[model samples]
Structures are given as structure tokens and as C-alpha cells.
Target: MINVFQPSLGEAEAAAVAEVFASNWTGRGPRTAAFEAEFAAHLGVPAEQLLFTNSCTSGLFLAVELLELGPGDEVVLPSVSFVAAANAVAAAGARPVFCDSDERTLNPTVAHVEAALTDRTRAVLVLHYGGRPGDIAGIAALCRERGLTLVEDAACAVASAVGETACGTFGDLASWSFDSMKTLVTGDGGALYVRDPELARRARQLAYYGLETASSLDAAGHSDRWWEPRVGGFGRRIVGNDVTAAIGSVQLRRLPDFVARRRELTELYDRLLAGVAGVRTPPTLPAGHRDSYYFYWVQLDPAIRDGVAADLLAADIYTTFRYPALHRVPIYGAGELTLPGAEAAADRTLLLPLHQGLTDAQAHTVVEALAGAVAGRAGAAPAGE
Candidate 1:
């Protein structure tokens, strides 16, 4: 079966892994440090500005913690995002305030987030959906106007851009995922980018369990040596590891090519299925915004989604619904939250076969199958058909 998500790891990745295996140091050390340096450089930031973590989730959790967000604090984010976005806030002892998104962009707009802000609102978490960058400048302006911190959840947005600025660099602190399914696969890894030196230092502290790294809490003002572990700070780093970074560096080198391939695939899908009935492809972003096209999401008319999905499955063409609405998930509990657009997207959005390795033929096959399935459903007569 053509899988919905596949990590396009080949000789390059295997070679990287083999190198790590050959080396005795598999913990978070040289390789991890190098990866962080390379990633920060890629983002046009100083090496000292980045922190590597186990997962984007951990990076986000660390961001929330560094900001001292707590039970009385409210963090605003789009309800349509990955549940991890909300969970990070909840994990930080902050309330997750859900907001509506722009239907056209499928992104949380600055106006919507601004409207959701309460007196308790502490930070704004913005996610770049489907690898398309959100309106970072507008959101940043809103955050500045309101004196709120901005945390970017850029798990799907590696290499994505809005105008000239990269998606992950717009917010005060941004988290990126290098999980197997993302554009950049690192086994299971993530990174954090910070614009502020002090916050960056604090984030490193939190990621390493509040350990007084030489760069962080060195009261002696020595730059080379770390102070002895203090009793109060969170002790021991849990997430950052070397093996993941070893794999990550290789993936990072290929990121530009992977992003280009996905965009090419998306263009091919748009062309192949342009006028197909009941198949609504999301619009391309304005030229200034470079969308990485991680998942080519389609909005199927409610009537045919299930049948079409089943047909694709039978044809050995895999597909997926990226996520269900946060409130709809049993774990989050069904609150009194009313988000119509998010609820509709949860019901109708379908992720077609999209990855760096998908060929033109495979993309066309899925589109053709989707059209056929929708047509077959339309022709069905009542329940007896």
C-alpha cells in the first residue's frame, strides 16, 4: 500500500546512523551540538540562539515553562491545530484558549487571536498549518500591542516562510519538529529558536532540568565551566540526544530539496484535479509566502468523504485525517467550546498521499480515485443501492 506518511530515508540517513553506531558517544553531546549549530545557521540565527530537544512537544513545553505560564494564565491558539499545541499549554499549568481560524488560509488570523485574548492571556501560540506559514507579522504586531509573548508551533513548517522571514523565526520563541513524519526526519527530535538571549538561556535551563549550565546560571561569571548543580533548579536534561541529531543533520541537508519536491507534487495535484467534482483543493498561498506543503489537504464534500476514503484504502492508496478538533477529543473533554469552522474541518478534511518521494503517477492515481469514488457515491440510489 502507498502509505499516507513515509520517511524518505535512504543511504544518506543510513550512513549517518551507521556513523553514530560506530561512535561510542550516543548521548546528547557533539552531534547534538553540531545539529543545533547547523539548524540555527539555517535559520540565520547565532548558534547560541538555538536549543535541541527530544520532541517539538518538549520544546513547546519548555517555552511555556520559561514564560512562567500557569493555571491563572491563558494561552491562545487555533483550535484546528495538532492537539499537542494545546497540551503544551495545559502541561504548563496554563489554560488553553481556543480561537477560530481563517477559512481561506486554514490559519489562525491575528484578529481572531486578538479577540480571544483575556486579561489572563499570557502568550499566543501560532501554528503553520500544512506547512504553510501563518501571518506572523500581523500576529507579532498583535502580540507586541498587547504585551503578550508569542510561541510558534512550527512542527509542520520547517523551511516555510512568510515573505522574507522564516516561519519559526517570527515569534519570540518557536518550536520545530523533526519527527519521522515531518519534512525533516530525525527519528524523534525537535529544536527551539529564541530571539531573546535571556529567554534562550532560561529555555536551555528548563530543557536541561534547570541545571546551571556554564552558559546559564554561572554566578561566578565564568564562561567555560558550569557551576555545581543547585538544589532548586530542575535537574538533568531529559530530551536532547545525540543519535537523533546524527540522523537530523543528514535530513537537514536535504530539507531544501524535500520542500521543493513537495511543492512540485502539490502543483501537480492542483493541475491534475483542478475541476474534479466534490474535490476542493486548498489554494496556494500568495507568492511571498513559501509553503512547504507537508500534507496536501483536501476538503471533501461531507457526502463522499468516507466512501472515497474507503475506495482509496481498497486501492492500496493510503490517506489520513490530519487531526480531529481539540474539543471533540475525549481526552480534552467536550467542553462548552463552540468552534464551527474547526468542527467542519475535522469532519471534511482529508490528507491525500503527500511526501517527498510521491511520484506524479501516484498523485494522479489518488486524484482519479477520489473523483471516481465521489461520482460513485453521487449515483447511488437511496439505501438499497
Candidate 2:
């Protein structure tokens, strides 16, 4: 079956893991530190500012906590966002203000964020939707003018950038996912970036039981009391281990090739699906916008959306929607909020299978199958009809 998401792994990854296993130490050791330095270089940041976490979700939670968000503080984010972003705000006793996204791009614009702003709002968390660096520069400027903190959920945007500036670096703090299905897979691990130097120091300490020092390696050569940790505050062990980093380093090295292939596939899909009836492709990126091509979504007539998905599945192709509108979620206490743009996009958008594992032949096959499915929809009207 053609999967909606897949990671490209091989003998190199296996060798990395084997090396980790051969070493006696595996928990947040030398390999983890080296990977952090490598990733920091990838994002063009100081190595000291980067910290590895167990997942991007943990990074979100850590970002929220670092900002000290609590009751009465609001975090404005797109309603069409990953559950982790909303949960991080909600779990911290802060309100997650859901905003509308552009119907075609499925990304909230600066105007969408402005409309959601209140005196109670403290921060703005924006996702680079489908790994497109959507309005992040504008939003960062907005946040600065308003004196609001910005946290970028760059989970889908590890390689995305505007020119040479990375997406995650646009905000005060950001999180990246390196999970099994992400562009750069590490089995299960993530990286966090804090812009402020002092805050970055605290971020690393806080990620690992709030210890004053980094790890045993620092004390190993300095003193006899190597095991005694100087507790800075109550924290948790959320640091990424060398076992995962070993694999991540290899994946990171191959990222450029992976992104190039995805870009090729994206253009191919665009050419093939351009004239397919009842289908609407995602909008093209503006100038200087480099998308990671994390998600290749197509919007269809809402009435026939489900039927088309069923047809695709029957043909042994797998597809799914991401990020149902968070405003409509009753748990967030904003179920009555009217976000026409987000609601519209949610009903019609469908993610097509686009990953490093997908070959050119498979991409053509996907479009062919999609075209056939849409054609088979007897009563399906063209998208706007």
C-alpha cells in the first residue's frame, strides 16, 4: 500500500545503532552531544542553545513552561494545528485561542492572529503548515511590536526556511520532530532551540531533572563526586539518548537529498494533478519560501471527499487528514467559535502520499489513482460547484 508517511532507513542507520549498542554508555552520551552540535549547525545556531528532547511534544510542553504560562494567559495559534500545541497551552492553565487559517493554504495569516488577539494574550505559537514557512516573518514582527512571545511549532518544518533563515529560529523558542514518520527520523527523538543564551542554559538543565551541570561527562574528569547531581529545580528526564542520536545523525546527513527528492515529487504531482476535475492543489509558495514538502494536500469538494478517500483506500493507497480544527474541540471551551476559513479547509483537505520512500513511478500511480477515484464519484460536482 502507498503510505501517507514513511521514513527512509537503511544499513547506515543499522550500523549507527549497532555502534551505540557496542558502547557501554547510551543515555545522552557523546553521540547525543555531537548530534546536537550537528543539528545546531544545520539550523545555524550556537550549539549551546540546542537541546534534545524525547519528542517535539515534550519540547512544546517545555516551551510553555519556560514562558511560565498559566491561567488568564492566552496563546494564539491556528485552529488547524497539531493537538500537541493546543494541549501544551491548555495543560499549562493557559487558554489556546484558536484562529482561522487561509482556506487554500491551510495556514493562518498574520491577520488571522491579529483578529484573535486580546489583552490577555501573552504569546503567539504558529505552525509552519505543511512545512511551508507561512507568514512566520510577519508574525514574528507582529509579536515583537506587541511584546508577545513567539513559539514556533516547527515539527513539520525541520528543513523549511525563508532564504537562509530557518523556520524554527524565527521565534523566541521552537521545537522540531524527528519521530518515525518525520522527514528526518530518529526512531523517536526531537530537538529544541531557545534563542536567549541564558534561557538556553536553563532549558538544557530543566530538561534533565533541573541539574545544575549538563551530564556525568562534565564531572567525570573534574571531581570524585561524579554521581552527585546539583539539583537546580524540580524537573524531568526528557533528554534524547545517544542510541537515537546515532541514527538521527545519519538521517540528518542525508536530509538534503531527501528534501530534493520530495521537491521533485511535489512538482510532479503539481503537473499531473493540475487539470484533474474537482481537485484543488495547495497554493504555490511565494518567492524565497523553501518548503520542506512535509505534507502534500489536495482539497476536493467536501461532498465527495470521503467517498474519494474510500476509493483510494480500495486501490491499496493510504491517505489521511491532519490537524482537525482545534476550535471545534469541546475540550478547549471554544466550540462555538466561528472560523469559516479553518472550517472550510478542514472539510475538504486530504493529504496525498509524499515521502522520501515514494518514487517517481509511485507518484504518477498516486495521481492516476486519484484521478480515477474522482472520476468514479458519480454525483461529485467540481470543487466550487
Best by lDDT: 2
TM-score of each: 0.92, 0.96
Off by over 4 Å in 2: 216-226, 378-385
State candidate 1's TM-score: 0.92
Question: Taking the tens digit of each residue's C-alpha lDDT, what string does model 1 give over 181-251?
Answer: 88898888899988999878777766776765533454566644445555336634645777889888989
Candidate with top TM-score is 2
lDDT (tens digit, per residue) of candidate 2 on 84-108: 9999999999999999999999888
Clash list (residue pairs), candidate 1:
209-234
Q: For each candidate, what is the lDDT?
A: 0.82, 0.93
Off by over 4 Å in 1: 214-228, 330-334, 381-385
